[model samples]
Target: MAGFRWWFMAVLVVACWMKGVAGQARQQQAPAIWVFGDSLVESGNNNFLRSTARADFYPYGSDYYRGPTGRFSNARTFSDILGDWLGIAAPPPFSDPTAAGNRIMGGVNYASAAGGILDETGQHYGDRYSLNQQVVNFETTLSQLRTMMNPESLNQLLSNSIVVMVFGSNDYINNYLMPNIYATSRTYTPTAFANLLLNRYSRQIEALYSQGLRKFFLPGIGPLGCIPNQLATGQAPPGRCADSVNQMLGPFNEGLRGLVGQFNGGSHPGATFVYGNTYGVFGDILNNPGRYGFTVRDKACCGFGQGQITCVPLETPCFNHDQYVFWDAFHPTQAANGVLAQRAYSGTTNDCFPMNVQQLAQVRPM
Candidate 1:
């Protein structure tokens, strides 16, 4: 009996070691991610188009990705951060031909600069890529995936993939902020306007959900009114945020939470919606800029607010980027983006929802 017990213990130890090795191997298999959204996801698609949304120039991707070839931001965006956390390289830009080889095992960026949910929004506005076009791009990529891999492999890709989105601010800024088409011609009150915008957004979300996408990380609005550009125009308090514009984002976020609830309760039990509470994250930074290593809270780090001094212009180049929360009046600096990405994954809400970025990550199909 003693001899038999000793043999059994040795067998158990070897089995445990083998199981640990298998688990480590599985972890090495990184999950693929499909990024879909607005200018935030723009990986130089705008450079090809005849639009002012182009970023295929200097100082854009210089700090991180480097060289004019890397036009998407300095280091990487939220999607890249998430991909890193998952142990995979950030998805390559869709325009890259090498994407075919990488995408079969990884993901793609389908975001277009100035993109919107409706096709007509971009045409009426001047430059943005309408959300419809983004969807078209997404579908095209899906076809490419189909051509590259078998059905079983494709299904595996779909099953393990994550999709992220950050949008709606463009519509507010371009249409609602100054009281133009959406408010006057469309006749929308603030509350009604939010509802209408959300309705359009819901349609887009539903369409994506229909396409076998179960994991979603959707960002809510940030402190838009406090942006350097907006502050330049509004009467901002010293070291504090403006109420009128910042307040608007709350209702919008609330409406989004309600929408997520509806989606979760509907037929798509497999679908998980994680709300990116960017507003709270940005607010935290605004409320305590010093804590986050920010100094220039009112103006862009790279732009001249007084006159024609822009961040990228020949005469008006950036001096110190770390002091500024925004690289420009509208966009946050890479540091800010990194903080927001961390906050998204952690789900540490300042005053938003129960789900954070980390919670949202688990929204994949079983």
Candidate 2:
């Protein structure tokens, strides 16, 4: 009887190990990539909306894929490239009819153009979905996910899934520094305003966490002041970026880093929050364009005027987008976005604190 019991235990252990290895392989091959944010990742979500901030038009997606796709870039957005890297089919936008069914199991992009950390931040853009609204949208998707799988299975899937939040640019670009508005600037200092954004950001992360999201990747804001639009509008000496706006990003990124650390250090089991130092990575690209095979990191490859506006329909794009960084007035070209996404996924701790996105996907809580 003792010998029979021992044999049974050994078989059970081997079977469990095989199951675990199979699960790991499945996760490595197809970890769901849930994205929630703003223009940097809108995909096709904003297409159904009657918003001026949408990118569902010509010349916007000329570099890759079909027309529009509701992405703000001239080609594949960072998230699209990232999905490819992760070995999963690119997630359809939440608003895309194709994503209406069980196709959502592949993940979804709830990002909207002009969406920001604050509700009021993107209001001027007309019908832009705020971060809170994005969370609400996510909840709707979660309901659908629940219907598709058993509760236990759904919980396990969500626990193993990855959530990405990319925002903050519009909060500054359209809200605080919109020239005459002076709302945020007058009400709070840079540091104070950063705290406010960070506070809201914490809530956003917590909101997602409450939904069983376990892995999080928060991409920090890039150097907004150096973007073509800011450079064109600001009083910076020729060829110099608007330092004031860029300076504001520092406090926000610092706050984000701390927030991630806090979450990781807390008692939340299976929770992994990573901060991708996009600000630093972008700055590196700007400072050393040649290292990334770029000649022009300043001007927009698809916009009209000297970095004054974005790519308009029928308007001409640059002869070679690969040589430039900025695709429009605000977004990065596909080439630049590719570099940024690669870094966020697997770069050193300097680029993605705690861990990069790839590491975040593989981690299983002890």
Each model's lDDT comes to: 0.66, 0.84
**What is the C-alpha lDDT profile of model 2 across 1-366, one tens digit per residue?**
999999999999999997874454344444588999999988877788878887777788887658777888888898877776666667888887768676888788999987888998867768877899889988999988877889988887788877888988888988988747648888888899999999988887888888898988898899998899988885566888888778888999898898889888975677999999999999999999999999997788877735667689877788888898999989998999999988987799999999888887778854
| Estimated TM-score for each candidate | 0.83, 0.90
Model 2: runs farther than 4 Å from truth?
1-30
Candidate 1 regions exceeding 4 Å error are 1-30, 68-74, 96-98, 122-127, 180-186, 235-239, 305-310, 349-353, 362-364
Q: List the residue pairs that clash in candidate 1.
A: 114-128, 115-129, 116-131, 302-311, 304-309, 344-357, 345-358, 347-356
Q: Residue 195 in candidate 1 has what lDDT? A: 83
